[model samples]
Every structure is written in structure tokens, then in C-alpha cells.
Target chain A: MSDVIKLAHGDGGKFTNELIKNLFYRHFRNRKLEEGIDAATFSVNEGRMAFTTDSFVVKPIFFYGGDIGKLAVCGSINDLAVSGAKPLYLSASFIIEEGFPIDKLEAIVRSMGDTCTRAGVNIITGDTKVVEKGSVDGIFINTSGVGIIESNYKMKTIESGDQIIVTGTIGEHGTAIAIQRYDIKVKGNFKSDCNPLNGITENIQDLYPYIKIMKDPTRGGLVTILNELAELAGLGVRLIEEKIPVSREVKAMNEMLGLDPLYMACEGRMVLVVNKLYAEKVLNRIRSLEGCKDANIIGNFDQEASLKVYIENYLGGKRILNTLEGAMLPRIC
Target chain B: MSDVIKLAHGDGGKFTNELIKNLFYRHFRNRKLEEGIDAATFSVNEGRMAFTTDSFVVKPIFFYGGDIGKLAVCGSINDLAVSGAKPLYLSASFIIEEGFPIDKLEAIVRSMGDTCTRAGVNIITGDTKVVEKGSVDGIFINTSGVGIIESNYKMKTIESGDQIIVTGTIGEHGTAIAIQRYDIKVKGNFKSDCNPLNGITENIQDLYPYIKIMKDPTRGGLVTILNELAELAGLGVRLIEEKIPVSREVKAMNEMLGLDPLYMACEGRMVLVVNKLYAEKVLNRIRSLEGCKDANIIGNFDQEASLKVYIENYLGGKRILNTLEGAMLPRIC
Candidate 1:
């Protein structure tokens, strides 16, 4: 056992087996992962299942709030959870650079195991491949998740008179990663907002019938996601700028960095579109949850207007917001 | 729309959406992928299911017989297939280096879509991430497959007295990749035997009752796999070297390069451990197929011997083979 990953670890040989047994299997211990077979087998309930994948190329493997491990688990599971499915199983694959530290790898893997445990999901099967030292920067993780959607828990799409909800404070993840990557001097406990939404997804199922759409705005952030949703629903969205929650620290960082918090990624937050009548109920339920105290009703889409997003300012001025064009931030999630 | 990938392509903005719509959607051409949601939801039958994932980082993206794209598709599908599951759906995640050519990406993607078409599987959902030029090599593909296994079609594991049958010639894939990467001269055509095994898995259900264990010999090749299977099953294996099939070109290349064909990789090959009584019947069935034309009974394990692999040579001499340690080849798959 070397201290750093070597090419032999990915050669589909003895070393690879030991790495899987020691690191991945030790952390994500379960019957399927313990099998160490070519694939994992499990009996899934008959129903519509959500299938999604997200690659974690976050620059610094370890950020303030979470590392790539937690991000990988939460990102993939959230996709399924937000889609109104009970996040069940996940397959993780890692592409590691030669000479990467084994200790760091173990820490990342343990973080993933802890996340999966809290989320009540399993990392059933996985693959590990080590490339030349320079071929990859450090390590990249790709997680794909599968979840069964009970018919009773299916969430529908948004319509006119729907109310929008931002689950928590915005831009924390982007702010955290930026400080780590850019070395920003000022920092006041602004770590990433990365976590599994299974908590909210499970509790909100009580009102699932009234829920329209649920999405976690990760990459292009809240503004861009709202624009996409508006276009898809063929409506205009009006947002109360003040109601959009951005922590004082995150706002200060965003202002100083000349970055829009609306366009900043939040790994663990979800935007919910619910029937206006039940919006308050959904918000109250989410607000009582562990990671969603800041949940609030933002605004609703206008059925009359075209596909556009308008944000009303504190001074009573309204401005049009458009979809993100160029890449704003890379490898933030 | 640009000729080369820009950082914005993975920025989760306008460019990322366009790249996915144009390249992935145009090639995969499926309704689920077209849904363009956070995750794809499909109804699957209730049963024991198989899930597997693999990441492809082969150098020289394109080589004889197949490119990385084809390898990604077949490799993932083959895992489920070898597990005796009907390959159903796959989610592909790509990590492409910035500035990679658009045409090449399109070709690789089209190859993937085409492979899915031939394999009768769909690329339901996928994620695309682009990193800085130096962060990764040309491109890497991570595919996770979900397949449904009926009660009858489920494959079993190896048992002593079970016969070992190889689907086709060995070392062709490793040899083909080597010649392309190392610029080896004086070589006959040595193309990789890369392909999906869904066809065989589906058609072999009738014999599933007798199929003890089936595994695709990829990296670390046949010898290493035999060593693994022997230890896992707690039995001893004896292979007849003269009976094992190897193309003359591959054999010559292995000799010239001081590599063992038994340990050379194969993308589309499988090692089946079946009831010795039905071994011949299964080999004949596989031999009648296109890719499995060279399928043959290579050897069997002895019930009473220790966990070791003994390969009988052309001169009736036998030698013990051990597990693979250091990497003989890196990034070959």
C-alpha cells in the first residue's frame, strides 16, 4: 500500500481490489458494495424511477462546508429527491490522478458514506480508475442515482397562480468555493450550502399533490434556473428581490466580488413551485426542517406575460432578467 | 455552436444547454433525454435489477475496432449483460477538457448514440462537464447502467467443477491500443473486440439455470480474472493454453512486447463459469453468435484443489499464475 495512488490502482488488478475493499467499501459498507461483484443487484419497487447524474469537478476537493464527496452524494440524490422520488441507490465512479494522497481519498470517501447514511441511500456499486499524474488535476467524481417514485408522491409541473419558494439562503456554495479558489481575504463563516434534500423531500410528501415543481438551482444559480422554468412554463416570473434570501456574509462577498448571488450556485437549496393556496403550508413545513429554516415564498409567475423574469427592487423598480449566456463560474459544483 | 469546446460549455449556462441539446440530444435522440429535466423518470418493472458504472479514459480516443465512445457504451452494457440482466437504460456523464474539438466530440457522442442503438439500450439522462485544458486529458466518459433481471434470467456465480469459456480471442484490445499509443510497427490488423453483450444475455436466458458465473474480462485480462475468481470461489482453476483462442497477430504482438495474452485486456469478451455438463452446449450457442465466434471451453476448476490458477502450456507443462500487481498498461480502457 503506497501513500499515494499509483497507475496500478486502476489497472483492474489486485491493487484496485484492495483500494475498493479498504476505501470505498469500508466507508460505504453495505451488502451490495460488500459483494464486490461486477454489478450490484437489488429489488426495486415497480414504479416510475428518477435517473440522474452529476459530475463533481469542484476545484478544491475540500471546501469549508463540504468536500467533493458530500457534493457528489448530495447533488445526485437531490436530483432524484426533488423529482419526487425516494432516492434509493447510487453508483459512484472516480477518476483519480496518479500520486493523489490515499489519506485524502479516504476522507472524501468517508464523507460520502456519512452523507449517504444521513440521506438513507446506498452507494451500491462503483468503479475506480487512476490516470497519469498530469492527465488529471486531482480527483473527479461522477455519481448517478436511481430512485423509485411512488405514484402517491409524484410532483407535477407549475401552472398559473403558482407560488415560488426558495428553500434556504442563496449563493453560499459558490461563495465558499470562490473564497477557496480565489483566496479572498474577507470571510465570515460563509461555507457551502451542500447537503442532501431527502429531509425536505420526505417531509414535503405530505403535500406532494399540491406541489408543482421542485428544482435545486446548482450551476447557473437561482436567476438562470428561474428563467429556464419560466420559459418551460411559458409565463413571466416576478420576484420580490428582498424576499430572495442571501445571507449578509454571502451578499457582502457577492457585492465585493462583483458576482450576482442569484447566479451563484447553491448545492443544497431547492426552488419549489407550489399551488398558491398551499404555498404557505409547504413553506411552513420546510421551515421546520433541519436545513431549511430560511424557506419563504418569493413570488409567482404571471400567466399573461411572455417568458421573462422580472425582479422588483426595494425602490419599486422592476428589471428584466435573462438566462445565463457565458460561463460565469466553472467547477463550483 | 463554436468549433471547439469553451469553458462556458460546462458552465451550466446557455452554452452548456446548447451543447447538450445539439450534441447529446441530436445523437441520443430519445424522448427522455429530450425531456431536459433535472432527472429522467421511467417506469420499470418490479424485479431484481442490476446497476453498474464504468469510466473510460483510454488514450488515443480512437483506435482500431472502437473508440472511447464505443468502449464506454459496450463496457457499461456488458457489465449488466454479464450479470444476466436485460440492459435497459444508461446515464452517461462526460468530463471533457476545454478547447477540445467540436467535431471530435460530436463524433464521439455519435459513436455512443450509435452504440446504444445497436445494443438496444437508451441513453436516458446524462451530465456534461468541461474543465480547464490542463485539468483533464482529452475526454473521459462515465456511464452507469440500470438493467432489469427477471427471476429466471438472473446469472449465478462460479462453482468448482464448472467449465470456463471465453467469448472470443484475448489481448486484441490491449494490443490494438498499445500499437496505437506506442507506435508499434510491423503489425497485422489487431482490432479491439469491443461491443455490447446485450444480444447474448437476452438470448441465453433459457440456459441461465446452468450458468454458474459470467464475467467480462476487461483490464488485467483473463489470467488476473481467473486468479480473482479462484480466490472468490475458493477453488482451483486449470487452463489449457493450447485451447485458449488468440489471434495470430495478437499472439505475435504479445511475444514481441513480452506480455502475456492471457493477461491482456478485452473489451467485449466474457469468461463464463458454467456447469461442466452444459458447458459445451453454452459454448456452441455463443460460438454461433457474431462476436462470440471464437468462444471455446478454456478450462475448469477442481473442487478439491487450493485457490490457485494452473495453466497447462503447449508442451503439457503447467505453471501457476498470480494476481496482477504493477500496471502493465495504463489508460488502455
Candidate 2:
């Protein structure tokens, strides 16, 4: 009966039932969720859909721009969104360390509910399990979401000559978390660019119609994503070093620490491959959207049938962008 | 580079990418998962679908009947099955402890792959994250599944006069786990009842057409689930104590350990509410199926608008079956 969660709350007995009714159900009240069973049954819109799952083990649980809850919701939502899906339903499962504060858990759950509202999705059903204190760090959340891809926007490829656009200033999320994790004191008004990207994508529906491929540069960041795409499409990408957006503070930290921002994680930004005809139009439309004022057509598919990624330098020299190979950072998402 | 898993394997950089391409791809190769991105895009079979998620942290990872990997797949698949869905695509995420053996991880993933194969589902996409050595136990898996429902069997309630039938002997999953966790020696052929219930349900569909509600007796077990139905339907259930099936070994262990089988988990069994007119027919159909040879009609909804569960004894006495209120067993799933 203490306010803190006990091992019994996850034992699938009465305590678990009460915890669910008092905490999760209190925040995620909805018709499908009201059934309150193992799996939530609901109607799905007919057509193509995207499904994604991500586990958030971001240390400290609470971060500068968002907590693990917000990160979980937005992360999965962004995955579905960039796939041209209208993120709809989500299921959240939590692995909490025993002795975790109930107040903090409630706050995280409330944040998740709020994020779902902002992203136009519902948390239908979920699971919670508690482990011995040392068995887990505070808490880890794994969220899986299902979304209906808008038929008209179920876009396709990264053909040669297509322009590649970086949705906004890169590496803000990676920088914000890095600063906090390392306790580096060099400061500016730095916050994670951790917000839902679906709304912004919806705003540019006219341009979305022209885009070929869309993806959120999350864990491995922009460099890894570009390499993966180029390899998959058997094409080479040519990005201008000066054209990609980076916040002044992040750029300063990158230079000072000898870090590459291209490999840093970004929780909210996206990478798009659109045809040259709509390149400027897409960039202009994204610039008008909030959180995307720094949108730029940073690169292009420079070659066909060549699995390579190259960066054009400020001095007009070219360097190959190799796929990131090892851990520069962990749990940035 | 050693045989043990390193942190870099989950760093979302090069090592992580290679792990996915080599290990997971070799086991769960499927068309839907070939995209290998943040989200897997796929076409949906129209109509209503069931969405469910579960995180498995059953301690001692491997047990008599199945490991956490198998439990993860079957658990989520069963949730969707009980909701009348033909489980389809699954998304898996892992929180691995640093220094865990790569062979063990591979075994777990292989178990997941095999379970999905048995359940007729595909592992379309997944994620991996490695936390520092004590931040997590050896491993924890979270699986989310999307499945299509045979609309005809999509059911509603536990009405008065509905027959309650248990698919098979209960308490095996809980007992198997308890014996392992406590290192008890109860010499007998023991294994967790961890088979996929979807195929069993599908086999009985012709007779299951009369069922009103179906649910897996997982966390709360038979007693808790029966109480939940009574409370939800605002009805009282009456059961013949001797009719409820219990395996001889588990029953003996129950009496020897002062444990109640009614509150024990059964990973592979289901609790069903069916019209009295079809109870015997459905029982016959289920009895003819694998894992349900011991199926029996153990109870019935006896009263409307009265939230109570009562059992009739062999000696003509009666007792109340209260909802499980405390931790009898934890993590049996």
C-alpha cells in the first residue's frame, strides 16, 4: 500500500489490476482501452500501414527537452510518419525497477498520454513489469505503433538526381543529451529537437506528393541513414558540407570536441529524397513550418549503381562518407 | 570481437547494423522485413485487427518448457488470438545486459524465430539496445503484434447462463517457473504449457462460433480471470470444484507447497464463456485438439447483476472464489 511500486504490482494479481486502473487507465481513457484486456481490439482503416517498435533506454529518464515517455511516443510516431503513415495507435510496455517512485511513473505516463494527443494517436493497451532494484536502471520503455499510410502519399524511391533534404537543424537532440550526460558547462539555449514530425509533414502534403523517400534520422543519425539508403538503392549521395543545417551551439561543441554531428542522433528531424523539380518548393514549405525553419536541400543522389556517399567540401573538395562503424554514443534516443 | 556481446552491437552504429544483417536476418527472413528500416511498411488485410504488446522478463531466461524468447512471441500472439485475431506481423525489441554471451542471444533470437514460425507470424522488424551490465538482467524482450480477426468470431460478453470452459489443465507455467526460481525438485515430467493458442482456437472455430468471450489466463490465472469476468458482467459464477482440470504433478506440488492452482498462470490455456447449448460441443472439439486433450466445462455464469464467484464442493459445501489480491507468483509469463 506504499506509494512506490512493488514487485507485486507486476504479479498479474490484484495489485497489478489496481495499479492499472488507478494509474494507466486514469490517463489513457478511450473506447478501445476501456475494454481493459490483454490485447485491445479495434477497427483499422483499410490500406497500406506501417508498424514500428523502439525501446528507450536513454539514461537519466528525464532529459532537457523530454522524458523517456515523450521520447518513446515521438520516436515511434516519427518512424511511422516518415514512412508516410498517419500514426494512429500505440502500445506501451514498461520495465520498471522495483522501488521506482510512483509519482515519477505517473508523470511519465501522463507525458505519454499528452504526446499521444499531440501526435493524434491513442495508447490502446500496455504491459508493466517490475524487476529487483539492481536488475534494471530506473526504467526502460518499448513502444510499438501502427499507422495507416495515406494512399496518395505512399511514396517510393531515391532515384538518381533526386534532391535530398535535411528536415531541420541536425544534431540538436544528440547535442542536448550529450551536454547533459557529460555535464559539459559550455552553454547556450540548447534543447532537443524532440517533437512530432507528422504535423509538419502533413503541412507539406503538396510537397509530400512529390517526395520519393522519407526517413527520420534517429539512432545512427544522418550519415548512417544516407549510407544505408545509398547502399539499398545502389546509388551514391552527394551532400554539400556547408548546406546541411546545424545549430551554432551544436556546431561549436562539435568543433570543440572533435565530434561529427552527422553521426549524432536526432529524435525529430527527417531526411527526404525528392525530385529536382520540387526541391526548392519542398524546402520553402518546410521552412514555413515550426521547428523546420532551417530546412535545406542539403544533398542529391549523385550517381546511379554506385553504393557510396560523398560530401562536397566548403573548398569544393570531395570526401567519401563512410558508414559509421562503432559506438560514439549509446542510448541517445 | 570476442564471443560475448559487446555494447557496440546495440550502439545503433556499424556493429548494430551488422548484427541485424547477419543474425536476425538469417533467422527471421521474410518479405515484409526485408526493408530493414525504422518501420516496416506492409499492406494490411482489410477489416478489424487486434493490436497487442507484451514485455517478457521471466527470470532464469530458460525454463523447462520455453525460454523468454518463445514466451515473448507466444504471449503476444496468444493475446491477439484470444481476441479472435489471426496473428500476423510482430515487432521485437531487446534490452540486453552488456557481456551476455553472443551464443545465448542468438539462441534467444532463434527461439523467437521458431515461435513465430509455429504461430504463423513474421518478425517484420526489430530493435536492439545494450544497457550496462547490471542495468538490466540478461535480457528482456518486448514484442508487439498485429493480426486480423475472423469477424464472425469477434465476440462480446459473459452473459448469465453462459458456460465457462477451461481449455486444459492449469498452473503448469507458474509451477514450472516457481520450481526453477526456487530450485525445487518435484521429480516428474514437467514443462511450461507455452504452446501457441491461435492454432488451437482456429481449429475450434466451427464449434467456437457460439463462444461469447475468450481470454488467456496468464498473469492473474483462473481465479483472477474468473473474478474479472464476474465483475465485468456484473454476474456471479458457479463452479463444480472437482470438474476443474489439474495435472497430477502440479496438483501434488500445489498441495505440498500450499499453493492454489486457481491463481496460477497457464501460458497456453484459455478461459472461455460460451452459450450453455454449445458447451459440450465446443468442449468436444477442443478436446480433439493438441494441448487441449484435458478440456473441460468447469463453471457457468449463474447470476446476473451480482459480482461474486462461488464453487460447490464434493461434500456439498460451497466456498467463495475471491479475486487474487496479492503476489502468489511473479513473471510466470
Candidate 3:
């Protein structure tokens, strides 16, 4: 059941079949994705479309709560989802190193298929290439997605006094990947926040039309996302540090590693900027989703000239959040 | 001017600037690309769209006639082109190794920008990430493109008696890459056939409204492509070996390496299956293009039961061209 992949795995033959079935299908089994075809097929209602592409090269294929395959699918789908579009199709391309395990590749592909099915998208077309052993790392996946948005459903821009809300906690994905990568042991259990955010976006979009910008706090985390929005909108943002909601485990780990949780990456969480009047309804709608039950308003936009991000401390002191100079955790995504 | 890449090349600052200016922009300079913005913005006629994504990790980044950057842009554009689409926008993502030369990365990006401009496409958005030295090779590029296809244009399937034509010679790309990779010495000069095929496709589409199928021979080469088409159409194909043109140098090199020229990859060339009546016109149109001046009719489809592909040799012998058993040249694309 576990053998290192030979070049035959990519040869489009029996070995490729075994790899797809045994490893990939094993972990990513789902009802709609059982059809083993070159591309998954589906239909969509008429609408204008939005599309996005993302590649996952996370060092360890399998990490805390998710693997590279799952991450690849979710990351791409979520990107399309937050752009106010209903993700419909995805194309996957793989670059596998020569000696990567066929079992591992299968697991990754199956997981990706299952993730797409859950997100209600089809894997329509794909390409696979193999490189010599030293040329590449284990495997790298590039996924491009297409989503349809009804012509009328344009999300507006963030304005002064708009509430900025986050779905659940932050820093979980970064911490999880970091810990698993370094094999660090902690007293409490830790898992990645690497779930899809489509459901929450769907819920909020259904209830209120006043929600402004929505973005996943990925690479530079909540702080960087806020900074980017501030600069784009020519505004400032203020948040209450105590109410920002970081788990004790993440905080402790950040302290241990001399890192800041605010700068960590979160795979599944998103920041929503909404009109102040609709913030309550949006929060309630988001709370009904499974992974976003802890949704909270983290900050508000301000019309300040400085264009800075400030967090009000528990002791009532304001601290500035600066953009990260370099990636805190290199290949976490 | 030629030096090994250093870490500062990917720092997103001063060194990155000089690298882009000297090596890449100097060679591929164009007005739109010179703006040096994160995304290139442009306009297109209104229509439904076809989109595609591709990543290039060809080893020795710099190949015979082209480098990874040009290949990445050309590959994505070609995918859109063959789909009967008018390519408009592209997004490039770069994953740079820690010590890659800033100059090289800049040169590559500029080359990519130039390629996009020549193909009448723009780089609309991009993401850049840097990994530790050992985590990645020199640099890997992922490009996603969106193209506008005329609503009236539909891709047609190949039918029996369709004449298959190949643009120019085959195996030039594979032989060139292989020669550089293995350090093979050949008496005659050789260069990779790595130009974009969108222009040639445009000319053909303009003349023939009924071109059945079009495909570029890349990773698995011409034989695999023919086999795929055969399987898709549930028919057999008969190719005349002498009529299938290849440069003498390439043929000599193939014999030297114990390789078959028919199984080698070609980037710029394409195999087109057209209704027999239009074959001559299509070949003439392709020949009118500078690089495809030698386009020739090489084979024809047949309604045989076996779905096999065969080549008639000069010695009056017929040889089966089977699906490639394994990758003949990894990363040839």
C-alpha cells in the first residue's frame, strides 16, 4: 500500500491508476468526485464570472489538520469565493519530483478532488509533469478556478466607520504548519484553521447586501490585510487587542518562538468589512456557519491621515502594527 | 553581466530593479511592459472567455533559444490559443529560491512581460514568494491567463479522412534541451523551437472556419499527441515517415542519442487536423508565417477499428507508434 513512486506513476497507465485510487482516493473520497475522469464536469446558472489561481508548495505535504492537496483546493476556491463569485470549475496542474511516493501523490490528488466536491466545484482539466529527483521538491500543485457572480452582486468598498470582522481565530494555520514542520511538542492539542470559507461567505451574502470587502488573512495575517485595505482606501483602522480573539495556545507558541500571532497566517479565516448598520446582521449570519460560530467584530475603519493600523491594548495603550519585512514562516502556504 | 544569481535578487528592492532593467527589459523592451507595475491593465472586445493556468520549472532556467520566463508565458498563451480563444489577461506568480540571482529573476520577469505584450496579453496580477535555499531550485513561475473567445467559434472534433499538418520541423525543442542537459555536441547549430504559436493559430482560424482539431506536441511529443487524438476520435492515423519533416541535424542527434525524432518534443510547432479539402489552404496559410514556412501535410485520419497510429517507412514497412511507455524527456515542456 505504501511504495515510493516510480516514473510510471506519471506514465498515464496502470501505475498511475493505482496511485490515483489507493492513496489519492483513500483520503479524499467523496460522493460527487468518484468519477475518475480527466476533468470533472458540472453546470452553472447564467452570470458574469470571477476567476483566481493559486499554487501550493507547502514543504511537508501533510501538515497538522490538512495536507497540501486539501490546501490547494481550498485556497483556490476560497480566493474565488471571497471575490463575490460562486466557484464553478478548477484546473489542477502538478509538478512531481522523480522519487515522490505514488501513495502520497494519490492521497494528495484524492484529497483535492474531495475538497473540490465539497466546495461544489469541478476539477475539469489537469496536467501532470515529472522532473528529475534533484530538480524539484516532493510535489507542487497549481490550481486555477472560475466562479460566476450574478451581475448585480457587486460587493462595495470599505468606508469610514465600517466594521471589520474576522471569522473565528487567527494564527492557527501558521502555528500548526510551523509546529509539524519543526516537530515541536506542546502541552495542548493544536490544529490548523485550514477549512474552506465559502459557507460563511454564502451565509453573509444571502442575508445582507451591505457587506463591503472580504479577504482571507493569509500570508501577512490580519495585520497585513488591514494595512493593505487601509492603504488602498486611504484610511486607518483601529482594533481592540483583547477582543481580537487569539487562542492561548497560539499566544504561548508565538511567545515561545519569539513571534507575533498578529503576523501569522490563517488558512480558513477571513476579514469582512461591512457598513456599521449591517454589522450585527452579518455577524449573526456568519455565526450560523459551522466553522465561523465565533465570528466577532475586530475593528473599525477610520478617516485618519496616518493610514496606520492600531490595536488598543488590554491596558488601554495603543500599539502600532507594522508590515512584515520578510515571511515569518516560509512555505506554510 | 553574466553572473550566478545571489539572494538579494529576490529582495523586492534595489537589486531586483537593476536585474530587471539590464538583462530582461533590455532584450524584451516594450512600452506597456516597461510600466513595471504588479499587474498590467488592458482592454478587450466583449465576448465569452476561455481561461487557463500553467507553471514552468524547466531546469537550467536558460535553455537553448528561450528561458523559463518566455516558455511560461508562451505555454499559457498557447493553451488559450488552441482553445480558440483571444488571450487578454495573465497573472504571474513566482517562487524564488533564497540565493537566485536578482538579475536572473528580473530578466525572467521582463522576458515574461515582453512575451505577454507580443501575444497581446497583459499580466494583471501576481504573487511572489521566496523559500529557503534548499527548498527550491532557481525559480519557478506560474502563469494564469484569461482569453476572450468569439461566441460563434466552437472547437470541432477530428473526423475520418481529415488531413493532419505539422507546422515546420518537429523535435527541435526536445533535441535542444536534451543537448544542453546532457552536454551533447553536434556539428550543426541547433536552437529550441520555443516561439509562441498564437499568431499562426490566428492566421489559420481566419482562413479555415472548419479546422477540426489543433494541438501542440509538448511533453510526450508528436507520437503521444497523435495517439491521444486517435483515442479521442476512436480512429486510426497513417503517417508517411519521409513526409514528416525533421531537420537533418535533429535526426542525426536523435540517432546519436538512441532516440526517435518523432518522439521528441516541439514547442512552436502544432499538429492540425483539417477537412481534406481545406488542408492545402491551411498549410499555405501556415507557411505564410515567418517561423512556419515549412509547414507540411504529414498524415491522414482513418476509420480503422484499432484506434492505432502507424508510420509508413521509406523501406515500405509500417511501424506502430504506440503511446509513450514512459516520459522520454522529463520537463521538456
**Please, what are the lDDT tens digits per residue for candidate 1 over residues A1-333?**
789999999998878988988888889999998987788998876778889988889989999989999999999999998888889999999999999999999999999999999999999999999999899989999999998887366556668779999999999998899888988777488789999988888887879888888899999899888998998889989999999988999998888888888888998999999999989999999999998888889889888657889899899998888877775678997
DockQ, structure candidate 3: 0.25
Candidate 2, clashing residue pairs?
none
Second chain only: TM-score per model? 0.97, 0.96, 0.88
| Residue ranges of candidate 1 with Cα displaced over 4 Å | A151-157, B151-159, B303-305
How does model 1 fare in lDDT?
Answer: 0.89
Whole-model lDDT per candidate: 0.89, 0.85, 0.74
DockQ-superior candidate, 2 or 3: 2
* Local lDDT at A283 for model 2: 84
Angstrom error of the Cα, residue A81, model 3: value is 2.2
lDDT by residue (A1-333, candidate 3, tens digit) is 436766655644445556656654455554323545322333343446565666787868898788998898888778877777667667677778878876677678878877776777776655566666776778888877767664234557778899998989889999888888788877676888988777776666564478777888877688978887888778999988877878999999989988888888888998889899988888887877898877899989999736999999879898888776556776777
Models, CA RMSD each: 1.4, 2.0, 4.3
Off by over 4 Å in 2: A154-157, A304-307, A317-319, B304-306
DockQ of 2: 0.73
Give the winner by lDDT: 1 or 2. Answer: 1
lDDT by residue for model 2 (A120-194), tens? 889997999988778889899999999887747755766788999988999888878888888888758888888
Best by lDDT: 1
| Local error of candidate 3 at residue A68 (angstroms) | 0.9
